[model samples]
Target: MEDKTEEKKVISIEDRIPKLKEERKKKANRRLIFYLTIFFILIACVVYLQSPYSNVKEITVTGNDVVPIEEIKELSGIDDETNIWMLQKRIAKKDIEGHPLIESMTIKRSLPQTVKITVTEFNIIGYTEEKGKYYPVLVDGSVLKDYPMSYRGDRPFILNFDEQAYMEMIATQLNELPEHVLRLISEVSWEPTKNNKNKILLYMNDGFIVDATLRDFSDKMKNYPSIIAQLDPKEKGIVHMGVGIYFEKIKKK
Candidate 1:
């Protein structure tokens, strides 16, 4: 009877505690994984909504003319109140491209916070006079914009020529003008009054005039100060600085 009681007391772990504990552990691990997955899903959704593409907070302008900043924004539909993330570069480019005055533009971003605009201005070749009104000419020599009578009177300019044609000839030369000559020039009329082709009048501040043909204009205009040095500054006369630097100085009548 004692031997029979000892065999019964020796219970097998397979029939009880070990199996139960393993089942419990599997259930607990599944629960933990479920909770972790839910947590990460919530985090990913939040991140996606708050990313750079969803919003815009700042707008900046650089390399611009003071006159066009506000106007450009209006035309571009890029309002001060608009979000940066909403800006589309292609759309913006299309908007401003209509304005002939604007040469080029580039847009950039600052993370999720800001947008920047960079601009390059049109090249001005000469100036135009219409019914005593004056306007700056673009590189193509077209009238950039109109001006009033106050702009007229003794400005040197390339005389009447097609705006587009003149730009190719005169734009580079205008850029190369010396600081002294540049300052002294009152106007640049395309196609002069006398046999207008290939000729321009550069009116000087020192009461002299330069009849400069477009050919070798940069070189001719470069020597203008020395040309002015020999002239009588007080007299109202024309100094021909167009071809080979000739100064026909005449006293005021």
Candidate 2:
């Protein structure tokens, strides 16, 4: 006896072609969308980086007294509209420190749109006479060319000295003196003794003359205030420190 069997139907490739093409089309569309999304994100990032929000809009300067704020700003080369992200702080510091007055400097970034510059300047110790102008002498033993109408602060006048080394030595010695002692000095002259080229003559504001050598100026000058305290203030004389510390009163003529 033959049993009844059910037949299975097979789908032809021609009939499945439309479904395969549709699946491939969907995949291509998905890939295209992914590429377009990445491209848009990259473009957005570039635009954000170039916008005004990424630039330095404000600058603050501090720790400066003698140098003008405008001068420091100009030297730093950092101003409004400068890109904060692209600023090289080290380079800017080097540039600002090139000014002879600036002893040292520091640069810092304060968040998204601000920069801060701090500077320390060399102290002006005295003035040197050249031709008819009085050039500023710094504590570092360097002189400035620009001659102001008048010198600021109480500083000693360096007179009759052409030797740079001697001038520098005088500046170094004066720089190390106490503020009180420095104020007592009215003039400094390079008066070399027959025995010593390092000898100097100082005319004190108190009508006393100091005979000292550059080699021992700083060490010996420190005792000036205490030494003067022991002397008769009414007696104007010469204080000698070249050989030994002594005082010689000038006789009234």
Instruction: Give candidate 2 regions above 4 Å deviation.
Output: 1-57, 138-140, 146-150, 251-253
lDDT of 2 by residue, 1-253 (tens): 1232222122455567899999999999999999999999999978977898889988899999778899899999897778888888878889899887788999888987999999998887887776667677887677787634255548888776678887788888889999888888989888776878887889999889998888778789999999999999999999998668999999999
lDDT of 1 by residue, 169-233 (tens): 77667767765566677765565456657777766566566677776777877877776677666
After superposition, which runs of candidate 1 have C-alpha atoms over 4 Å from their true positions?
1-55, 131-134, 144-158, 162-168, 178-180, 190-197, 230-232
Q: Please give the distance, in angstroms, between residue 133's alpha carbon in candidate 2 and its true position after superposition.
A: 3.3
For model 1, what is the C-alpha lDDT against the true structure?
A: 0.65
The models' CA-based lDDT, in order, is 0.65, 0.84
TM-scores of all candidate predictions against the true structure: 0.66, 0.69
Residue 143's C-alpha lDDT in candidate 2? 79
Q: Summing lDDT over every window of 10 consecutive residues in candidate 2, give the lowest-scoring window.
A: 1-10
Candidate 2 clashes: the total is 0
Superposed by TM-score, candidate 2 places the C-alpha of residue 197 at a distance from the truth, in angstroms, of 2.9
Give the range where candidate 1 is weakest over 10 consecutive residues by summed lDDT.
146-155
